[model samples]
Target chain A: MRLMSKPHSARELTGLLKAPTGIVGFDDVTLGGLPAGRPTLICGAAGCGKTLFGITFLVNGATLCDEPGVFMTFEERPEDLEANFRSLGYDLNGLAAAGKLIVDHVRVERSEIEEAGEYDLEGLFVRLGFAVDRIGAKRVVLDTIESLFAGFTDQAILRAELRRLFGWLKERGLTAVITGERGEGQLTRHGLEEYVSDCVILLDNRVEDQIATRRLRVVKYRGSSHGTNEFPFLIDEDGISVLPITAPRRNLAVCNEIVSSGIPGLDAMIRNGGFYRGSTILVSGVSGTGKTTMASHFVNAACLRGERCTFFSFEESAEEICRNARSVGLDLHAHVAAGLLRFEWARPSLYGLEMHLARMQRDIETFKPAVVVIDAISAFRGPAGDVQSILLRTVDLLKSSGITAMFTSLRSGASRDEGTDHGLSSIMDSWIKLVDVEENGERNRILYLIKSRGTSHSNQLREFRMTDRGIELIDAYIGPEGVLTGTARITQEARDRAAADQRERESNRRQRQFARRREAVRRQIEELEAALQAEEDEEAMLLGEDELRDATLKSDQAARAIRRRAAE
Target chain B: MTSDAERLDEGAQEAGEDAGHYYLRLYVAGHTTKSTLALNNLKRVCETHLAGRYEIEVIDLRENPQLAAGDQILAIPTLVRRLPQPLKRIIGDLSNTEKVLVGLDIRPKVACP
Candidate 1:
């Protein structure tokens, strides 16, 4: 963020002024832009965009910097150049008509000319000076000055004339761009780099594995400190935009707002009820593990919340994705028609990884979506390291823009490793890994919250199923046999129910037997008491008969017996 | 088509039409030594070969700098053959007479003289 905020102010401190190139990310890479009022040599091989680079500089200078420019071509004609750069949206005719540019073609044919004696390039100087004065141009571009070598046969005279040309350009205080053809070992075939001593940039178009990537590097910037690394650049319909490798480190703004992940079951896993707004989430899994399903759910949820979403799909077309989402009860088509969701689909082999990233970045910038979903980043063809670095930059862009981004990576193997195949799990704020568990003659999808940086998340392996309704996260069976899903979980649950039933039945039988024994003991005690009472009664009767025999002699004994009976 | 020597023979060259007449334009920056030498060499060559049939026009670019873009000039002391079916240019001071004649397509007819 603090790189080059005010270039004018920076000039005061560094004593070197810069002219902004107006190319995206290019100014930052150069700490501002090319040194102002000086010549910069841009060297590259054939068809490597040397002319385009020079044209972009001139066009941008004319339209953006309020500075008129002179484009002197040593090869192609003005009409051919105009037609070639028309696709890039540069109106050469209009600019020239507006007096903001001048196109001068320096045609030199060797077959029609003979050098009989000494001659200087005074004619070239006069023409260039006239054009520059006509437009009061501040910038000048000599597209591939190396063509002079093919046109002229005198090396000594040509070299001396070139040196004088550069000196003349500098004396006029014009910021110049002189493109050169790359030599075998030197920066330029004629070593023009030795003459232009202010700045030197190299453009390279390299093809590896049949995929071409364009890169730009600032080899030397005299009296200025600039980024020294080779940066990936793209030339599309909008013109050139360079992607600097270094991501915004600590300057990204932190957000506390949370958005749901669509599935309540999954949202419940996160401590904040969902992912942080503007945080990068990676959903990695093997084939048929519902990576796209999870990403779609997020998109659906974002759209439902009245937030715009951009879904970038590398594997499936928009129609196919909408159809699949319909089966899962997510009407992505409705959101799309509502203008809340946009789907961009491109094949993985369409372009280089950096190009894809640049295009996606451009789309995001234009759409200004609150949420973005990249379905299957693994489909991008490149080395793991390159893909990871590109993803790192992508994530940085999203985070710095405060846009919630979700990227799905297709893991080739169902390994237990929590990292993505490209090793992007580290830079992600949240990483959810999905794997299919095969047990009980069936395979079931399970999700594991591998890493969540800013929020607490469930570490359990959540069993999820994609039914016709949607993806539902069910409680995985956690037992001594480890986490089980699908039929294994169902069978374990049934076995647990039967064990509970048998334990209840055995307790009921034991209680009944104990009650029967207690009832028998009570009845035996009652019988023994009855026998004792009978024996007491018989003894009392015998005493009463002996008393009656005595009652014949005395009536008082009967009265005494009656009184005794009354007392008892 | 009038050279310095042909101007002397203008009365005799007046009968000749525009065709079969050599028209040469020499482009020079200033009155430099090389431009002077190229101009003198051309006059000598015309007198020796076509004489009254050749015409030479000397243009000094130092006065009218913008005129340099007319013929797409990059070198000083450049001689352009304007007449005949095909046009040709010879850069540098015309010190080499044979090469200048070949460049101007004045060789085959030089044998007649």
Candidate 2:
């Protein structure tokens, strides 16, 4: 945010008195560019791209920045320089024809040339003036200023002439790049930096762990606040681009956008539907934990959303990956055919990590993809610094351009933490860890949402299965006893059902016993009723016998009959 | 190429074996006074001790200064023995005949001590 709001006044303060090199990513570090209208000394050992730097600066100034340049080389011929640069896609001859650039090859054969008395390099000055005037050039490049010294017999005069030459370049109002050979104790072979002191850039090419990295640093830049650290640079077909050693300034405008995870129910794990747009994600897991499958899902999802996606596969070939995805019913090949998906397959051992990064950056810039997937970033095995730099530049390039990137890495040893070998996990906006859990003689894949920035996410471990349809995150089996996986989960489900049936049968037996007791009570009530009726009948018969015995007794019998009737 | 280099080496060996046939290379900046004097003095000494049995090559460093690196030449008007098995260099205008002879690895006849 601070970089985005960099005060305009600050820019003008640092930028007013400078000449932009027009080399990609270099001008920013030089506080605008090289010191304007002054000679800058560039010294390096042989084969360290010293000449290439000078020529590129001139070519860029002429073609891209609309500043014509004059290039005077001391060693190689003009045709050789033109041919060499032609392969780098810079047309020196074409630029010369267009009157924008001039290449003068200064040949100094001592046998052919003579050094007369009382000379001060007026011939060289005249030639340079002619070339500069012809092209109306504002930039000049002297590839290896020492070749001229080798022809002259007097060192005192030669060094004095060199100092005068630099002063003349400034007086002529030209931004000049002077190349020199690195010496043992001093900066240059002849200590040329002492003569040209306006600015100095040091280029170093060293091989570490059998891998080569080229770095550049500003030794001295007069009157400017410039980056002093050594920045690694890339030399490719398109020329040179020095990647600053510092982390990218966070100035990108963030958007509240999301892209879904192709697997169903997976989006819910990351709370706000999916990962934050233009964020870096680290997908770390053990071997065969479906890390590659997860990457396929992300790439496929981006493609399905009609957004372009590029897959950098260091592990499997495109064919092998497509076949693996097809087994899970993901049509990766269809997306490739639809021009929505692109695969960059290369072996990690082929080049240094920086070269791989340069290639990746070039591809991403050309493809303009919305998402990029690196299948197994751990495949780049090198010095720890190399690995860290690879991740830094990759992350910076993706996030600053509003492109989300997913990097998959394989975790070795028994450590299940998502900590990367290069410690890049700390910079990740979201990290998803996959583990293979073994229980009851079966192994199941489970994934965890370790952390996601700017969004809520589930911390619960989700048991995932790679079915024929696709990758599915099923609910973890929480049983009465414990959380189970694979065959143990199935066995636990069967045991629970049997226990429910046993409780149902025990309740039925108790209800049957209550019904039997009710039947016995009903039988006893019936017997009591019958006994009461018999007693009443006996009394009636006795009363009838007494009435027949005498007339006088009739009244008693009638009374007994009336009593019996009342009882009935 | 190996046979050619061997033949050249053998030829140098033959020249050293030939008595009084000295092979010399004189380094000079140009046709200056010091350079001409050094050449004349060397020719006179070689003719007296090894008359008509010596060869000399004068190399002007000013005209072909690149050759100065091949012989590791430092000062102008220096004399180098080209064909001797063990080469020798004598600086200056070769003014003393006795010293020049001694520097050329030849013992000068000590007259009276």
Per candidate, the number of residue pairs that clash is 1, 0
Off by over 4 Å in 1: A1-14, A251-254, A269-271, A317-320, A331-368, A380-397, A413-420, A426-429, A437-443, A450-469, A474-568, B1-19, B63-67, B108-113
Interface RMSD of each: 0.9, 12.3
Write candidate 1's Cα lDDT for B1-113 as tens digits.
23643453453356453446788889998799999999999999999977788888898888887777767789998998766536678998999998888887777565667
| Candidate 2: pairs in clash | none
What DockQ does predicted model 1 obtain?
0.61
**Runs in model 2 lying further than 4 Å from the true structure:** A1-17, A110-122, A245-256, A278-280, A310-327, A331-369, A380-403, A416-429, A438-443, A452-460, A476-568, B1-113
Residue-level error in angstroms, candidate 1, position A50: 1.7
The total number of steric clashes, by the backbone 3 Å criterion, in model 1 comes to 1
Q: Tens-digit lDDT track for model 2 on A18-38?
A: 888887778978978887787
Error of 1 at A108 (Å): 1.7
DockQ of each two-chain model: 0.61, 0.02
Residue A359 in candidate 1 has what lDDT? 79
Task: Provide chain B TM-scores across all predictions.
Answer: 0.78, 0.81
